[model samples]
Target: MDKKLIEELKLKLLEEKKDLEKILKGFAKKDPHTPGGWRANVPKYDGGHMEEESDEVEHYQNLLSQEASLENRLKEIEEALDKIQTGKYGICENCGKEIEIGRLKTYPAAKTCLRCK
Candidate 1:
């Protein structure tokens, strides 16, 4: 793989990592005990209306789901970055073949080629 292309992918991954963390922080806090862990903020009871309380609960549940999804994507991006460091970037993990450049450009965190995926 070309060094320039790898560098471009690295930049894309880093930018995405930043964006994901920012989005997660809007509704979740970083977990101190585990690396790259996020805990969605729980809605607190302020003795408001019952309807409001229920709405808050529903929002909290949605945040939890979003947090899980973002965390998983972050992990995949981190893994891809690690592969780049180890000189394994662009190789499909499932088939040990070079991933298509177009696919990698579209999804820098991809773990497998289109066929394997």
Candidate 2:
């Protein structure tokens, strides 16, 4: 990839990383015991109300799944930024071929080319 394009992708990845972190922070807490890990904050219901408690549990489950997905994407973006710093960005992880510029523009965190994907 061209230097200018790589710079643009780097900026995009950085912005995405910041945005994901902000969103995850809203309903999840970073796991200090485990680096790069986050746990959804399960809201506590008062008086042991069964219905409210069940709803809270369900909401927690949904947040957990969303947090996991966002965390994974953040990791991918971080890795892609690292690859760019190491002069290995835009390379397909599966076949070691150059990824399409258009695809990279759409997903700066992509690790695989369209063919590999």
The residue-by-residue lDDT of candidate 1 on 90-117, one tens digit each, is 9998999999999999999999999999
Give the number of the best model, judged by lDDT: 1
lDDT score of model 1? Answer: 0.93
CA error at residue 64 for candidate 1, angstroms: 0.3
lDDT of 2 by residue, 1-38 (tens): 69999999899999999999999999888886755688
| RMSD to the hidden true structure, all candidates | 1.4, 1.3
Per-prediction TM-score to the true structure, in the order listed: 0.94, 0.93
Best by TM-score: 1
lDDT of 2 at 68: 80
